[model samples]
Target: MSAELRLASGGAPAPETVHPLSVRGLTVAYGDAPAVFSVDADFPAGTMTAIVGPNGAGKSSFLKGALGVVKPLSGEVRAFGGPLSRARRRIAYVPQRASVDWEFPARAIDVAAMGLYARLGPFRLAGRGDLDIARAALSRVGMERLAERQIGELSGGQQQRVFIARALAQGADLYLLDEPFAGVDAATEKALVEVLKGLAAEGRMVVCVHHDLSTLQAYFDRVLMINLRKIAEGTVAETATPENLRLTYGGAAQAA
Candidate 1:
C-alpha cells in the first residue's frame, strides 16, 4: 500500500488540471509585517516536495492558506487546478507532533480512524470497514501491534508514526504534513521516508514542512526555499545549493 495506506484516488491524478497545487499572488500576515508575500508556484502531481526556510518563514502559513485554515490577506490558493473549495476533501493535513497532546486518551487505532471523519461526518459511527481500514493503516507503519494502546502510552516516534497512519487513512490526493520527522529516531525516519516515497511512486502528491537540510536531497525530489517569501523552487539537486541555502536561511543554516 502506498503511504502505508492508500488514498482513495490510488492512481496518479487524472490531471483534471495541469497542476495539483498552485499559488498566485498569495499573501498572508499577522499584522503589518507580511508573513508571505505574493507567491506563485505550480506543483505537479506525483512528487514529494520539501518546504524549507528560516524559523519564521511562511512555510506553515503557505500550507494553512492552501487548506483554508488561515485567511490570506490577498491573492488566491488552488488545489487540483481549482479553488480549494473544489478539492478540499481530496486534501489531508498532518499537523506537527508538538502541536498535539500525547496525553490524550485515544488509542493508536482511534487516531488512525479519525482519518475517516471526512467521510463519516459527526453522527455516523465508524463501521467495520472503517476499522479495517484503520487497522491496515496502522500496520503499514509497523504499529499494528500497539493498535489498542493509548496514544499517551506511546513514544515520540510511535506517535509520529500513528499520525502518519492517520494521514494515510484519509485517502487524500494531496498530503500536507508539518514537521513529520521532528523528533524521531533514525530508523523511524528511514521507515517513514520509504512510506512517503511509496506514495509518490503511486502518483500522489506529498508535501512536507522539513527542517533537516541534511536529508533534503535524500528525501525530496523538489524543494521550495521560503523566507517570508519564496526564495527558490526547483529540483532538489539544482535548487538546494549552498548559495541558495544561505539566501534562504540567512546566517542560521550551514551546507547540508
Candidate 2:
C-alpha cells in the first residue's frame, strides 16, 4: 500500500510525474470511533475517478478530510504534491444535496455566486464580475435559465446542477463532489457526466462519491472501491471487477 497503483488503461502513467492529490496514513473519525481507516491513495492529473462504496461507508468523510473541513485524527493530505494549504485556492468541493437546506432564502444564481467568494475571501462580497462568472458557470451546467428562481423551487436535479455551477464558478484545478447523481433523472446524469468528462479533458482532476456500479466503466477513467478503508484503487477496467465489487459491497453487491 506504500506505492500507489497506476490506473492507466494504456499502462501506468509516467512515474516521474507528480499526482494531483496524495493521501498518506489518513484516518478520520467523528468521535472515538474511526470512520475512515488509514487510507493511502493518489489521484493523477487529468482523470475522472469515482469513489464508490455502500451507505455509511465513510466515502463522504474521506472527501471532507481531503477538503480540510473534517479534521483527521492522524496522517496528512497533499494537493498538487504539496501541502493542502498551499493548494487550497486550486481546489473546489461540492457537498451532498441532502445536506443543504433549500429553503435558506436564496436565488439559484445567488447559490452559484458563492463559488466566487473563494477569491473574495471571508469579509468581501461578490461584485458584478463575480456575478457574471457565476452566471457563466450556471450556463455551463444548464442552470442559467433558472438563475432568478429560488433554490427551493428547483427540482432535485436542478438543485444539484446549481451546486455544480457553484463549484464551476470557483475555477479550481481539482473538483470533488459527493452523491451528485443521488436523485437526478437520466437526462441530468448524462449532462453531468459529460461536464465531468470535459473537466478531465481540460487536465483538471474530478473525483465523485458515487453509488452507481453499472455506469462506472462508461463514465469514469478510474474507480476507488472502499469499505471503511481502501479496498481497491485503479482503472475501472481493473478495480471494478466482480470480486472487488463483492469485497466492497459484501452480500449487497451479490444481491444486486
Best of the candidates, lDDT: 2
Q: Pick the candidate with the highest TM-score.
A: 2
Flag regions of model 1 displaced more than 4 Å: 1-17
**How do the residues 1-256 of candidate 1 rate in per-residue lDDT, one tens digit apiece?**
5664444485653334567788888888888988888887778788999999988899888878767788889887778767789897788899989989888889999999999999999999899999999999999998999999999989999999999999899888898999899999999999999999998899999999999998888999999898888899999999988899889988778632
Specify the poorest-scoring 10-residue window by lDDT in model 2: 1-10
Assess every candidate by TM-score.
0.90, 0.91
lDDT (0 to 1) per candidate: 0.88, 0.89
Model 2, range 106-151, lDDT digits (tens) per residue?
9999999999887899998888999999999999999889999999
Candidate 2: segments with Cα more than 4 A from true spot: 1-16, 254-256
Count clashes in each candidate, considering only residues at least 3 apart in sequence or on different chains: 0, 0
